[model samples]
Target: MTGLVEYAERHPWLTDAIVVAALLGSGVLGVHLVGPGDSRPEDVWVADAVTVVACLAVFGARTHPRATVVVTTVCAVVGGGLGFLLTPLLLAPVMVALYWLAVTTTSRTAWTYGAVTIVLVVGTAVGADIDETVALRSVGPALWLVLPLVMGSRSRLRDALLDAVRARAEHAERTRDDEARLRVTEERMRIARDLHDVVAHHLAVANAQAGTAAHLLRRSPELTQKVLADLQTTTSAVMLELRDTVGVLRNGGADEDGLEPAPGLARLPELIEACASAGLTVDVEVDGEPRELPAGIDLTAYRIVQEALTNATKYSASGSASLRLGYGARLIIAVANETRPGDPGAGRPGYGIVGMRERAHAVGGDLRVSDAGGRFEVVSSLPLHTPAATP
Candidate 1:
């Protein structure tokens, strides 16, 4: 059914031919079946000729609706004037024209055109008094004319409603695609930040251990062995983290069981030992009772302290840093390290600091980095509890 409508739309001239055939066939049949019984041969010829002209006028109905209606209505009156009964079948051609007119134009235009045709056909049949029957002269022609106009208007309305529904569905599909793209972007950024933290912290500690081992190799061989052992531990730990980070690129996402427990505040002892191996001392302080923290906040807090001390190991004049954790209504974290002369004037922060800020904001918290007069400090506050759903 859909294919046939598309074909008709593509070839309008072919559609016009089909309509002319149906209307002409019905008109000729009506003339033979319902004409006057004692009609002359010439009267039959004239009535048939008028029917042919009316059917042909339907071709122009789609493009010139008003003109086509007038022509067909005039032809209908001419046929009725010649002692022919106004049967609906004989008026099929005029009805076809009105149907096309209604479908192609607005309701007001179609109604105005249909009313004029009805008035002309009915008034002429009654005025001529050629056919005396009440139904044939007055009722039949008016009733048939109105049917096609109603059908055409109904089809037009149905088509308009279908198009609106199709447009809405397309808009919803586009919205879903946009949301999917945004989610993918956020995931990519998270993986990049994690990769940076794992690589930077481990490499800094390993490099410091390797340098310390070289300095003590000839002077004291026993001390060099312990430094080399710490180097091996740092390398092994970094390799495991690197595999986990790379697994995200291999698989679309990490499965719950495939992941190790994420790094957080519980890992601080290891971070301090690694900094100790690098010849930097980290002093830990706690205010209020220390307790378990949310996974996201814990990981963010650990990364900030690790990054601050790692910077100190590479650049601090004092070679020592301070870490303070305050557990109150909100968890407060602060890490400070002494800076060398004219070091870190705070023009633009490095990727490590940027990553730390992004992690804090991701968990609905805030972090700030400041370099004030020989000291670099990172301070952040986080909500202790997440909103839970009620059963």
Candidate 2:
């Protein structure tokens, strides 16, 4: 039952055919009522032929309604005086035609054709000795012809409704996709900020310590050796943190096993040694007790020192630099190098500094770079306990 209803709704042609059959059957009943009284043999034959032609017109009503109306009208005119059989059936074909015209043509055309049909049917009755009242009554019910017009109008409305629904659905899908892209863009920005914080601070501290070691080596070789050991530890710490930050990209989580911890304030001495080897003089002053920091804070401090010293290696004219690390709830690191008059690294500030700043910001830290009296300095401070803090 469900399938049948669905098919009928979708296929207007099927409904139209059913309506045509019912209308034709009604026409046959009308003829039966009018009777074949006093009809001669030849008259009966012509009447039957006309009646058959009119009923058949209903069959093609949907495809060529206007043509069917014309054929039925001609048959009505020819058989008017002869018999009522063909004349009664005329209303069926005319109604079907009007319905089709209203469906396929303008309302004006349908109304015009409807007026002509009413006039012709009425006139034939008056001229053929049939009562004018009876003829009017016979054709009045053909107003059911307007069914196709209603159906067509409704079909157009249905199509418009379906189109609107599809458009809204597409708009919703597009909105969903746009929002997803926006989320990804915000996440990348956050990650970049973390990287800057972690890198800038550590690099700065390492640069300062290395400078201290280089200066002390000329006076006390034993103290220089101790500083070198500390510098090595700082380098190891920075390398570990660097690996963690990079690992986040390769493996999408913070808690993957088999990953090494990042370097933090604990590795400051090693950082100084690496800088000393790179020909930088460094110094260290500790004001606060060394305590564990969040991974992000540790990494940020390390990166800042690394980038500052890298900048020094590239640009320091005297081949000497300074490093400072102040640890607290937050870690502060600074590295500075004197620019040589003709050093290739002095004239250009490169990606090293830019990369450093980005790392500081990632860890919720701020980085500052400046040149004073031919000395380039970088400083960054980062908070502990930031989320996604790598160890």
Candidate 3:
């Protein structure tokens, strides 16, 4: 059945021709089976002609439904008026035309056309003095007109519902694709930020240590050896951190052998030790009891402190800095160092400050940089109840 429907859709004209031939055959057969044998030769020929004309009109119903309905209706009424009502098979084309109109037109137009067809056929039968009850004559034609119209209207409604469902499915697919693309873009930005922080902080420390070792090579062999040792340590640590960071990107969060957890506030002492090796002394102070923190906030806090210490070691003239951590409704981190008159690293163009500020804002916090009163200071505060914090 499905295959036949598909074929008919593909070859509509051929399908229509086949339908016309079938109706023509039915009309001719119906006439011979029920037509009166006592009728004159001229009357028989006229009845056959009327049946042929009515069946042929169905061929044009699909293309011009309203016009075809009018033509076929007139033919059916005329056939009845001429005493061609033996089998009522001449009304087949009118049924086909009404169905076409119902499927292609509005419900009002289809119903109106159907009503007009019934009135004309029944009126013609009654006016022609046919020897039959009015209700019996009317029943067959009424069913013929109404059934096809009802079936066609149902088909139209089904097609409309299918179109709506298909449209909604297409819209949902587009939304899914857009969300996937957005996630990919966000992942790329996160990787870029991590790369900047890792490379900038480690490279700055390595450069300072290398310079010191080179300057003291001829003056003090022991001091030079210590400086070179520190450089090696700094480079090795940088390599390990870089490997872990890059592995997170390559492996997509899968655990690997010797993979360490990300650095957080607990690693601040280690950061301070690394700065001390680069000829910078840091004095630390803490107020209020420190407690557990969410992973995102903890990581953000560690990175901000690490970046500020790196800057102080590279730019301060006094080779010393101060750091304070205050815990309460908010965690406040402050790092301060004396400004150097001609420090090369004081106004260096880099993303370290920007990255810190972005990290703070991401966790519902803020950071401030100040170079007033002959001192450079970085102060950042993060709320304990941030969106990223533990529930």
Candidate 4:
């Protein structure tokens, strides 16, 4: 049934041809059944001619619905005047045209056309002094026209609902794609920040150690060997950390063997020792008891300290710095170093400070950088409880 309906919609001409054939065949049969006693030769010819013309009008119903309705209505009225034998067959085309009009046009237009056609046909029969019984019999033709219009209206409503549903589905798909792209952009930015921290800290230390080793090579061979060893260790650690960070990006955060856990507050001593090996003496102090912290907060605190110390080692004139950790309701990390001679402030604003500020803010913390009377200081305070906590 669905396949036939689809075929009719696709090739309306074929549907019209089928309807014309049926109506012509029925008219021929009706005339023969009536015999010469009923319809004369002239009457038969008029009936057949009206049926053919009416069915042909149905071909344009889809494209020119109102015009088709007018043409077929006239054909129906003329056939009704001829005799009862021709009325039923001629009315088939009228019914098809009414259905097409309802489907293609607004309700007002279709209903108006249907009402006018019915009144004209019945009124003409009565005015001509046709019997009241025959005029009342035209009710069957009226019903045929009304039923198709109702069905056509229903079909039009169904198509509108389907189109709305399809539009909503397409909008939902586009929203999903936009969200996926946003997530990818955020992940790339996170990776870039991590890469900057790892490279900046280790390279600064390696550069200092290499310079010291070259200066002491002949006069102090023994100290030069130790500095060279520290340089090798710093560069190797930098390589390993870089590989692990990149691996996290490649594997989409899944753990891999041989990948070390990220450094945190507990690794502060090791960080200071690396600075000391690079010829920078850093004195450490703590004000409260230390406890385990949230993973994001711990990593953020470590990064803040590493960046501050790297700046101190690279720019301080005194070759010494100080670190203080205050563990209370909140964790406070502070690092300060003396400025080089004639230097006004913490050398200059750069990515290290920006990256530190970003990391602090990401973990719901805040950071401040200051230059007070030759001492360059960085202080960061983080909340004890964080969203990324492993509870």
Candidate 5:
């Protein structure tokens, strides 16, 4: 039985083979017992032959269960004229075929088979010349046939429902996995850009400063010390920020110790000071009450200002930018700059702009970047609390 199940699992054809074999074997057995002292040999033989053909149809039961039931039922009805002896026990194969069909097909089909089974069994019992006791007892067996049919149909339905649920669960899991992979890929790309902007740029500046210090070390020790001190400050800041960012990733974001809080409107003064050191003058302004905002909004506000200032420094010859922050129900941030004439980078936006837009949108906000009358502006506004945070 285990071998048969294994074979059926591996090869669907085996299921059909088993059905055919069962029907044919049952037919032969029924045919052998159809003869008795109560029935004529010719009549018994004819009935047995018809039953054998009908039962043999069980071979294609799964493929054509309705047809098999129809054929077997008709044969069973006609064979009644030959008495119980001629009929043999060929009804067993018919019962098995009908029950299997009910189990595999829809409920409507099962109902139809059940109605037919009831009619045929009752008609066969009543039409035959069997004793009253035997005829009465036959009803029990006829009713028993319905148990397998109903139970089998129910079992198959349950299995199909379970399979559907499992399929949906697997599909959901696959979708989640795909989204996670995409997010990771984007994060890696962002990290690469940050490394280029922060680490590479600072390292280049530090190297230049160190070279200057070396060149003046003997002749102007005071100048050398100043240059070296600036280099040390720049290098140290880079190392600290790098350690924080990389450490966050390496530790799965659990390490907050050396990590600086994300820059926000609160850090605008420091940002202005930093711009001064870089020879860029920034005018910072704040309007409206500075209420505490959601973390996402705060982070987005900071990034918008940072990206705008960075672009201004890289592309504007005027070395002057304006940073504005306003808080109402929403936080608004805007950075505008006077673009440098003949600066190729002034007109084109890069991933920094894209990152700013993405950050704004991530917090259910909007970002707008445009050039107006030779001035470039990046504006972003984010709601303090989104629908998801309303609880």
Candidate 6:
């Protein structure tokens, strides 16, 4: 069935040929039925010739709609003017032409041509003084002509509606693809931030512990051993975390037993111990009632503090910093450290501060960094309840 329809669509002229054959048969019948076969031979020949020309004109209606409608209407009126019966069969070609005109041309053009056709065809029939009733002379031709125009207009509207639906579906599919790409990009950036914070903070502490061990080697052998032990602990913990992170990437996910819990404020004591061994003393002060936080806010807070202390370890001349946390509608974190004019690591290029800010903002929070009054300070304000999707 589908193949047949496809074949018909491929040969469009076949449709015009079928319609023309039907019109010729009906025209012949209409002429013979005129007054008990009393139509003269000359009149019959002329009517048949005019009807054939009008039916042929139907073939061009799709290409030259207005011209085709005009030609068919003229032929139909000419046949009626020669004192022949004006029946619907005799006007079949004009009806077919009007239909194609409606389908191919604009509604305004089809209707304008239809009104002109009605005026010409009906006026010729009525003014010819035929024995046919008034209804046949005027209403019959108008009804026949109007049907094709109406059907053609409806076909055009349906086709336009289908095109609009197809276009909207395509646009939605493209939007879906764009949204998928955007999500992938955001995930990559989140992973980069997490890796930077985890690796940079741990490595800096390890480096500081190593330097301390070497500086104390000759003067304090026992303390050097303790620093070396702390160094070992730091490297071991970071390796386990690195493995955990990398294993997730390699295996698509971690097994339940293999997955390590992400770090949060509960792990701040461990961070304090590591920083103390690195010769950066962190004095932590809590201003409000401490409560457990949502995972996103907890992880973001931990990373911001870790990154800020790492910067202080690298850049501060004084080996002391203050860490403060306040809990209320929002969790407030502030880290301040003394800075001197000739701090050894003052002029280094790093993304630590930027990563910290990004982590804060990811949880619907904000971070501010300022170097004022001989001190460097990082203040972050985070909501206690963060969005579920934040990394």
Which scores higher on lDDT, 1 or 2?
Answer: 1
Sorting all predicted structures by TM-score, with the top scorer first, yields: 6, 5, 1, 3, 4, 2
Candidate 5 segments whose C-alpha is farther than 4 A from its true place: 1-4, 8-42, 85-88, 128-138, 189-232, 250-254, 386-391
Clashing pairs in 1: none
Error of 5 at 230 (Å): 4.2
lDDT string, candidate 6, 1-391, tens digits: 9997788779889976887889889987876666764654456788778888888888887788888888988888888877777778888888888888888888998899899898888898788456647766688777888889899999999989999999999999999999999999998888788788878888999999999999999999999999999999988988888888788778977899877677899999999888999999999999989999988789889999999899888777789999999998899999989888865555343588878888888789999888767788999999998666737
Looking at model 6, residue 290 earns an lDDT score of 98
The residue pairs in collision within model 3 are: none
Q: Flag regions of model 3 displaced more than 4 Å.
A: 29-60, 86-88, 106-133, 215-224, 248-253, 279-288, 311-391
Better model by TM-score: candidate 2 vs candidate 3: 3
lDDT of 4 by residue, 192-295 (tens): 77888899999999998998999999999999999999999999999988888877767768575666677898898899999998889999999999899987
TM-score of each: 0.78, 0.43, 0.76, 0.69, 0.80, 0.85
The candidate maximizing lDDT is 6
Separate clash counts for every candidate: 0, 56, 0, 0, 0, 0
Ranked candidates, highest lDDT first: 6, 1, 3, 4, 5, 2
**What stretches of model 2 exceed 4 Å from their correct place?**
9-27, 35-90, 93-139, 170-391
Question: What TM-score would you give candidate 4 relative to the actual structure?
Answer: 0.69
Q: Write the per-residue lDDT of candidate 3 for residues 1-391, one digit (tens) a residue.
A: 9999999999999999999999999888755554435453346667677778888888888889999899888877766776666344677888889889988898999999898888887787666456757677777677777888999899878888999999999998999999999989877767777887787778878888888788899999999999889889889988988888878778778475677677899998888877877778999999999988888889999999989988987888898999999998899999999988766667454688888988999899999998767788999999776584467
**lDDT on C-alpha atoms for all candidate structures:** 0.83, 0.66, 0.83, 0.82, 0.71, 0.85
**Cα lDDT, model 2, residue 67:** 80
Scored against the true structure, residue 243 in model 4 reaches a CA lDDT of 81
Q: Summarize candidate 2's per-residue lDDT along 296-329 as a digit string, tens digits.
A: 6676676567666667765677767777777676
Cα RMSD (angstroms) for every candidate in the order listed: 4.3, 9.8, 4.5, 5.5, 4.6, 3.5
Comparing 1 and 4 by TM-score, which wins? 1
